[model samples]
Target: MAKKKTTQDPALAQNRKARFNYAIEDTLEAGVVLTGTEIKSVRAGQITIGDGFVTINGGQAILTNVHIAPYENGNQFNVDPLRNRVLLLHKKQIVRLAVEAKEAGVTIVPLKVYLKHGFAKVLLGIGRGKKQYDKRQSIKKRDQERDLNRRFKN
Candidate 1:
């Protein structure tokens, strides 16, 4: 029997804070629409999805607040860093997300950005914002786990 091979995405950037601020309920892999210069910049890891958010405007899904630094060699035709980039998804998927986003406390956030077989992809998550107490509880749980692991090791 042959083992199935899974390819690793060429991850150029990620928003580490997303892990701490929200409890992700569901995740959707999306294709990002980008220009040539933007693609080059992303490939070089000059990008930030830290402040980005997913929104549905005019019946289309858009990724806003992402910063893709200008390509060093792309002096004449560089794309703007904060432009609203469209996210490619099925019509049904978009409609489902749009409805879900209308609920209170549910928001969409970017989790990671990477290249999949030469094309740029964004991993979007449907997340619920965590309360301060919830965050503290999570931290405490993590600390307990670490302490248990240390004890077991010794």
Candidate 2:
């Protein structure tokens, strides 16, 4: 049988610092609710998930602090760039995330934004804040790995 073609969506924005700041324990994909202008801006790759985070309130998941630049042609229709947007997730999933988020030092952070099947989605990560010592250890381990790779390639 001929294999069906599968194409992954292109990433619009990513929070590169999240990995260095937190230890992610789990991840899930969630749909984003966006305005017309916001969607246009996201498709144009004018979005930033760096400071964005997810919160579960009243049994709903909401994404906050993400910046989606206004569409050049949107003019008066453009909404606030940092407005909180709703994230679509199952009731069970929302409850689970809420429980996890309630734990001390645990948070729901947006790792990346992308378009999938014509809809915008956010990669939500369940993470625990890393200590300063953990960050230093991670950096040191990464450097050692790089050095080992270089030595082996020679």
Candidate 3:
């Protein structure tokens, strides 16, 4: 039998700062463990991953600071808006990430959240924190680019 074609788009929520504040070295896609209400909220686009960070705890990868707002009709069954959600990754990947995170100034952060075939997913990136000078350079470069674009339009 021929394989079925899929029309699913692979994106949900994006953390814009993840690209600006860090030099991302590697990225990995992973599944997120969510409660029923949380899933409902995400499907309705009521999720925020801006301040979230990833950590390996007790041999498992987990996400912290992600906020999924409660469904308006869901009172008793709603999930906590700021709970730490678990991430699903392989053991080898977890070990590698743990070792890499121990290196100076390296950390794990969630870059985006998206859906794949109706399942919620998140993009995790291993990044090195940018120094103050680096951030300033990026800002200067962005400003120059904007000016160049404006000049071209005139």
TM-score of each: 0.92, 0.94, 0.89
Tens-place lDDT per residue, model 3, 1-154, is: 9998775555568888887899999999889999888888998889888899988899999899998999888899996899888888999998998999889999899998888888898889999999889999999999999999999999
Candidate 1, residues 1-154, lDDT tens digits: the string is 9987656565688888887898999999999999999998998899999999999988789999999999998998997789999999999989999999999999999999988878899999999999999899989998999999999999
Report the number of the highest-TM-score candidate.
2
Name the weakest run of 10 consecutive residues (lDDT summed) in model 1.
3-12
Q: lDDT per residue, candidate 2, 49-151, as tens digits?
A: 9888888878899999889999999999999999999999999999999999999999899998898878999999999999999999999999999999999
lDDT measured at residue 41 in model 1 versus the true structure, 0 to 100: 90
Q: Is candidate 1 or candidate 2 better by TM-score?
A: 2
- Model 1: colliding residue pairs: none
Q: Model 1 segments beyond 4 Å from truth?
A: 1-6
Clashing pairs in 3: 12-114
Model 3: CA > 4 A from native: 1-10
